[model samples]
Target: IPFGFYLFLKTENYIVGWIATLLTGLMVLYAVYTKSLAAWVSISVEAIVFISILIYLVKTGKYQFKIKSRLYALVLTFTGFLLLINIDSGGFNLKFGGLSDQVTSVQEFVQSKSSSGVDVVRSDAAVKGQSSIEWRWSVWLNSMAMIKDNPLIGVGAGNYKIEYPLYNHKVVRDTKFNLESQLDRAHNDYIQAAAEFGITGFVIALWAVVCFYYILFCLFKSDLSDLPGKKLLLAAALMSAGTGMLFNAGFSFPFQRAIPPFIVMLIFAIACVMHAQKIKTSHTSIIDTRLLYAVTFVFTLLFFYIGHYHYTMIKADKYFGRTIRCYNNGNWPQLLNEADKALSYNAGRKRVLFYKGFASNELGKIKESIQYYEELIQYFPNYINGLLNLGIAYGKVGENAKAVETFKKIIVLMPDEGGYYSDAGHYLTKLGKLDQAYTYLKKGAELEKENAIILLNFGVLCMQMKKYSEARKVLKKVAELEPDWDQPKQYLKYIKEQT
Candidate 1:
C-alpha cells in the first residue's frame, strides 16, 4: 500500500496523495484520541514531518496548487478543525494529561522516597495510584541502569526479562507491588536497544535513521520538473513515515514486534524503488548476470533459514500452549509431556521448566520437583513462583531449615509482601520459635491489615503466646472482616472459653 502510494505521488497524482494523506491523518488523529500515549506521540511526529515537507515544497515552488488539490485540502482542513474541537473539549486530553500526571507522579515519588537511589524510582504512592505510569517509568529506569552497567555490550538480546529483577528497585521490593504483567520490553526501543546491544548498537540505529532522512533530503532536492507534484508528495509521505518511526522508537518497542518493522522495511523498499528509477532514467549500466545470480542464491538461502527458524518457533509456541492447558486442567502427566515436547523444540524455555517443576510436585516426585525448581532458580533467581514453590517443596520433604531460609529470601526479595512474612511466621511457629513467629506475624498484619488469613494467623499466634486479650481483639477483627466464615467464629468461641 505504501509503495503504491509512493508511486502515485511520484507520478504527479496530487489528488491521490492528498486524499491518502487526509484519510491517514484522520485515522492517526482518532488513534491518538483512543489509543496509548505512544500512539499520540508517534502519529503527531509523522503529522509534523508531513506538514513541514508540504510547506517546504510550497515555499520552493515545487508544489503547484491546482483546483482538484484545493478540494482535498478543504476536506483535510475541515477534518483538522473537527479534531481540534474534539481536543478542546477534552476528548484527547489523555495525551497531555498523562504527561502532566507523570511529571507530578515523579516529583511525589522522589519526595517520598528520598533514601532510594536515583537509579531506583520507586514510590508506594506511584505504584498504588498510577501503576501504569510507575511501571513504565520503573522499566525505563531499570533499562538505563542496565545500560550504565553494561555500556559496551548489553545484557544480551531477549535477556531483559531475565536481568530485570536484578535491577528492580528496592522500593518496589519493599512495597511488594505486584505488576499485573511481566516487564518483557523496556517500552522504549532506544533504551531496549542500548540495554540489549550496548552503546554501539544504539549508535548504529541512530546512524540508520540519519541516513534515511539524508537520502530523503537528497531526493527532495533533485530536479523533478518532469513530475514535480509527484516528487513533492512522495517526499512528504516518506518523511512522515520516517519521522513516525523515530518518535515511536523513543517511547515504544516497535522493533521488537513484527508489524511495525515490516512497515518500516516496506517504506525503505519504496524509497529504494524510487531511487532505482531515478538512476535507471539518468544512467545506463550493463547488467552483471553473475552478481544477480549470486544475490538471488544468497537471498534464497536467507529465506530458507528464516523459514526454518519461524517453523521451530511456531512448534515451540504450540507445545508451550498445550502445556499451559494441561497445567490449568491439573493434568500433571499431560503437562509434563507437553512441557517435554516444548523443550525438545525450544530447549531451556523458562516457563516449561516451571511447568515441569509444578507437575513433578503434583505427582509426588518431591526430589525431582526440588531439582527442577533449583534449575529454574539458577537461571531466574528472582522468579517468585519458582522460589515460592521450592519453599513449599522443601517443607513437604521435611527440610524445615531450607524452607525457612527460602521464605526469608522471599521476604528480602519482596519485603513489603505480607504473604512471605506470614509464610515465614508459620514456619517459625512450627519450629516453636514463638517470639520470632510473633514478630513476623505482627509485621505481616501491619503490612496487610485487611488480610483475613494473616489476621486469623496472628490471632492464633497470640493465643499460643497466652496473650488472651490480644487474641480476642485480633480474632474479633477477623470475624468482622469475614462475617460468614465459620473458622473465625470457632476461633472466637475458643477464645471465649479460655477467658
Candidate 2:
C-alpha cells in the first residue's frame, strides 16, 4: 500500500491513490489491533516520512496537500499514538487480566535474573515467556564489547558466533538459561554489522544512508514539471523505505534475512524503471527486440537453476527436521539414517554433522563421534555443542589430558559459564591436579552461587581439601537452596561426621 500510494502520486492517478490510501489505513488498523510491534514501528515510521514529505511540499509551494491526504495522515498519526499507548500499558492486557498479573510477571522476571546474579533488564514474562529477552540482551552486550575490541575490521563476516562466547558477558554465561545453545546473531543489524565489518563497515553504512538522503533531496528539487508530481512521490516512498530500514535495524538483523533485502532491491529497481520511463522520449531505443528476447531467455534459465537449488534445500531441511526429532527421542539409529539422508541432499549441511556426531556418541561409537565432531569443528570451530560432546568423547576414550585441554578451551571460549568451569575442575581433580581444580571450583561457585550442582561440587572439593568448616558452610547453602534435594543433606551430614 505504501508503494502503491507513491506510484499513484507519481502517475497522478486518483483511483490508484485513493485505493492505496484506504488499504494503507486498513493495514495500519490491523497492525494496531494485532499488537505486532515490528509492523507498528515500521508502519509508523513510514507514515511519518510520508507526512513529512507532504508538509515539505506544501510549505515549499511545490505541491498542495489535499484535504484527503491530510485526513489520511491524521488518521495514521492517531493509530501510531494508540500503538504507543498499548506498548506503554504492557500490551494493554490490564483490562482483561488486571494490571496486577502484568506487574507480577515483570517482577518475577526481574527477580529471577537479578537473584541469579545477572544485572540485566528482564522482559515481561507473560509476553516473552522465559529468558529469550535476556539472551538477546546478552548477545547485544557481547557484540558491543567485541566491537570495542575489534573496532577497525571486526572479527569478519559470518564470524559473530565464533567470537560471541569469547566476549560473552559474565552475567549472561552464569544465567543458567539455554547454556548449551550458541548465539549466531546479535539480533540488531547495526551491531551485527559493526561486529562483522568493524568501524570501516559502520562508516560505509552511515555514508550510504547519507547518500540515499542526498539523492532523495536532489530528486525532490529536480524540475520535472513534464513528469508532474513524480519526483515528490518517488522521494516520499524512498524516504519511507529508508525510515523503515533504520527502525527495523534496531531490533532485527534484517540485512541477514532474505526477504527484507530482496524487497529493498525490488523497490530500488522499480524506482529506476519509473525514472527511465519518465526520461525516455518517443524515439528512444534502449534495446532491440532480439536482444530483449535473448536477455529474457538467459534470465529464465538462471531462475530455473535457482528454483531447483531451493527445491533441493527444502527437501534436505525436511530430512534434517526428522533427524532432530529422532535425536530428541534418543533414536540414534533413526537419527543417523535421517541425517545421512539430509547430507546426501546437501553435503555442506553443517547441522547434519552435529546430529551425526551426537547419534554416534549415543550409539557408543566414540571414535566415529570424535571424527564427526572434528569435521564439524573444521567447518565451524566455535560450535559449542560440538566442542562439548567432543570433550566427553575424549574422556570416554580415557584421553584425560585431551579432555582437560578441551574443557579448558571451552572455558576460554565461555569464561563465565559455571558448567565449563565445573567440568574442567572435575577433570583436573581426576588427574590429581587438586590445586588447579580448587581454583576453578571456587570461581565456579562464586559465579554460579544458586547452582545446586556447582555448589555441591564445590562443597565436595572443600571436603577433599580437608577444610571441614568450609565444606559444612557450602553444603548448608546447597541444602537451603534445594530443600528437596537429598544429596546436599547427605553431604552435610557426612561433613559433620568428619568434623
Candidate 3:
C-alpha cells in the first residue's frame, strides 16, 4: 500500500506538474519585474511558496507536509483575491503584455545600432511579432499549414522560412496587402520542426523526452537518498521549461544558454545511470571487466561527440567576434573573410548571412548582397533585419515595387513611429502613391513633432499631394523649429514656386 501510494505521489509530482504551479507565479513576477502592480497576487503567492518550503525544511527536518506549506497555501489564496482588486482598479492594456512592452526598448536599441553602423544586425522579429496582433495570427496559421503540407519528413531543418510563403495562400487568400509574404521562421519550434524536420524528427525528439522521463522514473524507483525531493525539484524545473517552450518554441535561445537545461539533463542522466548500475548489480549473477571497459570506451566516444558539437559552436562564436571587429574597424574585406570563416562552421546562422549581405552591399557587390539577403530571408523569414536588408538590396537592383512592398511589411510589423514610417513614406511618394505617402509622413511628423527632418518631409509630401495650405503650415512649423535647417528652406522655396 505504501509502494502504491508512493507511485501515485510520484505520478502526481511529475516535473510538468510543478512547472504549471510555478508558471502563473513566474508570469506574475515578470509583470512585477516590469513594475506592474497587477502581479501583486502572483508575487504574494510566490513568497508564500518560498517561505513555506524554507519553513518545512527548517522545522520538520522532513521535506514534505509541514506548517510552512499550509502557511504558503493560505497566503497564495489571500493574494489571489487581492490580485482581482488590483486589476479592477487599474485599467491595463491587455494587448500590450509585459513581454511586448519590453520589445519597444529592444526595437529602439536595434535602430540605434543600425544608425551607428554597429554591424550588430539585431533582429526586429521579436519586436514585430510582439507588436502585431494581426501578423502573429497570420504567421501562426501559416506555420501550421506548412507543417500540414509536409507532416512526415518536414521541409528540412532550417527550411521553414523558405516554405512559409508557399503555405500562406491557405491561411491568407488576399495578395493585395502582401500578407502572403513568407516569414523567415515559423517563429515557433514545434512549427519549425514540423515544417523542417517533418513528423519523423519531431517524433524522435518527443521519444527522447519520453525516454528521459522513463529514466527519471527509474531513478525515483531506486533507493537513492533524496530521490523524491530531487524528483519534485526536477519536475518543477522541467515544468517551467516546458511552459516556456509551449509559448515560444525555444526561440528565447535555450539551446544557446550554458546553464539550466544542461545542468538539469546532466543531473537526470546521472541519476538514471547510477540507478541502472545499482539495479544491474543487485540482479546480475556475474559481471565482465571487459564489458565494463567496452562501456567506458563507448561513454568516452559519446563525450567526444558532445564536446565537438559545443566546440564547433564556440569556434563559430569566436569567428563572429572577429567579424564584429572587422566591421567596427570598417575593413569590408576582413568582415567578409570573418563571415566566411564563421559560416564554414555554422552555415545555418542568420547573423553571419546578415553581415555578409551588409559587407557585400557596402562593397558594391549588389548581386552578391541580394543572394545573401535572400538566403537569410529563406532561413529566417520573420527576421526583420533580413527583411529590411533584402528590400534595400532589391531597391539597389531597381526593384522599387519589391522594395515598397517590403517596407510596407516593416511598417505593418513595427509600430508607426520615428524614421521607419518616414522612410516608407518617402519611398511611397517616390512610387507616386502621393496620398498614402502623405498619411505616413504626417504620422511620422506627429510622432516627432519637434524634428526638423520629419517636419520638412511632411512639407514636401504635402507639396506633392497639392495640399498647398497644409504644405505651408508644415514648412512654417519646420522653419520655426529650425531656422538654419536647409531642407525646410528649400521645401519652402519649392512650395512658394508652386503657389
Candidate 4:
C-alpha cells in the first residue's frame, strides 16, 4: 500500500517518491512478522501490476527515467533496511526457498516453518479445502441456507450470531474436524451483509461495488497519454489497490476494517474527479492548484467539524481499554475508577457501563453495580452480555425475581442454550417456584444432556422438592458424569435417609 502511494507521488516528485520505499520495505517486514497472507498478496499484486505499468510507460516512450540509477537506489535502500532489521533482532535471517518448495499460502508457509526441513506439499484442490478455508466455505454455505428462509428482510441485526448456531450444527456435527467456532462473521462481507440485513444489504453492497469499478473504468479507458504523468500512475496504482481489495474481500472482511474502506473511497474519489475533468476535455491540468485547495478546504472543514467528537471517542476508548486491562489484572478499584472516567466522557457507551457494573459488583458495591447495570440495560436492552451480567448481578443481590425475569428474556433470545435455562431455573429455585424451576431445569438438562453442572443443579433441585426416588436417579447420573464429585454422594446419602 505504501509502495502504491509512492507510485502515486512519483508522478509529482520523483526524488521525494523513492523515500516511500522505506515505508514499503518496513510494511513488507511487518507483513512477514504478522504472517498476514492477505497483506502480502495485496502488496505483491499491486507491486507487480504497478511495476508492469511503469515498464510499459518507459518502453512505449510515454515516460522516461534513469532506470539503472533508480534500480541501484532501490536495492541499496532495501539492503540497508534489512541489515538494520537483522542487527536489531540479533539474527533476523531471510531466505529464498528452493523453487521446489513453492509455498503458496501463509498457512502453508507456517506449516513448512513449523516442520522445518519437511516438504509440505498441498494439492491445488486441497488448498481451498484446507481446514481454515474449508470451514469458512461450510459457514458460507450454511449461512445461505439460513438466508433462503427470509431472503428479503434477513434475520435482522444481532439476530445472526444468536440464530446462526442452530443452522450451523451440520458443520459442528462433523467428526473429523469441527472447524467452526463463532459465526460472528461469515468472513465474506457481502454474505455477512445478506445474512444480517438480507437482500437489501446485498443489493446496496453490490451497487456500491459496481459504482466503484465504474469510476475505475472511467479513469482506465481515458487517454493515458492525455493525462499528466503522475495522474496516469495514480490511476493505475488506485486500480491495483482497489482490485486487490475486491479480491481480499472475497476471502476476508477488509470492508469491516477502519482504514481499507476510506482508502478505497479516497482513491475512488480521486478517480471520479480525474474522470470528470477528462469528460470536460479542457487542456487545463487534471489536478490544478484550485482543485487541490478546494479538497484541502473541504477536508479541513470536515476535520474541524468532526474532530472534537472523534477526540472524545478516542479518549473514551482508551479509558475503556484501561478498564478492561484493570479487570484482567483483577484490580477492581482501579477498574471502577477507570470505567467511571470513561463513562464520564461517553455515558451512553454500553461497554463502559457494563465494565463499571462489573467492577462495582466485584468491589462488593452491589447497589452501585445494580445502578450501572440498570443504566446499560436501559440503553441496550437486547445486549446479551449486558443482560446476562445484569441478571447475574441481580442474583448476587438476592433479587431473584428480577434475575428470573432477565434469564427468561435470555431464554427467549437463545432458546437452545442450556446455560440460560440453567440460570433461569437456578433463580426460580431461589424464588421457591419449584414447579416452574423443575420445568426449566428439565429442559436445560435435555438440551445439554452431558452438562455435569446443570445435571448436578437439577439433581439438587429434585432433592429440594423431596422427590426422593427421582433425586436418587438424577444424583446417580451426576455421579457417573462426575465420578469424584462428593456433593452427589452426600446428596444421595441424604436422599437415602429421606427415603
| Per-prediction TM-score | 0.74, 0.76, 0.51, 0.68
Best by lDDT: 1
Ranking by lDDT: 1, 2, 4, 3
lDDT of each: 0.75, 0.74, 0.61, 0.72
Better of 2 and 3 by TM-score: 2
Judging by TM-score against the true structure, name the best candidate. Answer: 2
Candidate 4, after superposition: displacement of residue 158 in Å?
A: 9.6
Superposed model 4: Cα runs more than 4 Å off: 2-25, 44-187, 192-198, 228-231, 251-258, 281-305, 325-338, 363-368, 409-418, 431-436, 443-453, 462-470, 480-487, 493-499
TM-score of 4: 0.68
Of candidates 4 and 2, the better by lDDT: 2
The list of candidate 3 runs beyond 4 A from truth reads: 1-256, 265-308, 490-499
Give the Å shift of residue 229 in candidate 4. 6.5
lDDT of 1 by residue, 1-499 (tens): 2333344334446666666556655554566445465676676677677767767887887875444544565476556845553564545643432446545666765665575556454445645654444566666776687889999989888788767666666324223234334467777888988888899988998898887777777678867743356655876787788678768777777888889888877777776666666554565675998988999999999999999988888999999999999988999998999998898888757668888999999999999999989989888877777889999998998887788888887786567779888888888888888899899899998888899999999999998898989988988989899999898788778878988
Model 2 / residue 74 / CA error / Å: 9.5
Residue pairs with backbone overlap in model 1? 9-230
lDDT (Cα, 0-100) at 27 in candidate 4: 63
Using TM-score as the measure, what is the rank order of every candidate, best first?
2, 1, 4, 3
| Model 3: per-residue Cα lDDT over 435-494, one tens digit each | 888878888898878888888888877887789999899999988988887787787788
lDDT for model 2 comes to 0.74
Residue 174, candidate 2: C-alpha displacement in angstroms: 9.5
- The positional error of residue 496 in candidate 3, measured at the CA in angstroms, is 4.7
- 1-499 per-residue lDDT for model 2 (tens digits): 4675565455445555556655655655565556444555677788888878877777777775444644565466556545444454455532322234444555775776568554453333322444444455666776788899899999898898777767664334424223476677777888999989999999998786676566566666656563446466766787788678778778777878888888776665655555555454566666688989999999999999999999889989999999999988999999999999898888878868988998898888999999999899888776777889989998899887778888887878776568888888888888988889998898899888899899899899989899889889989999899899998888778877887
Q: What does candidate 3 score on TM?
A: 0.51
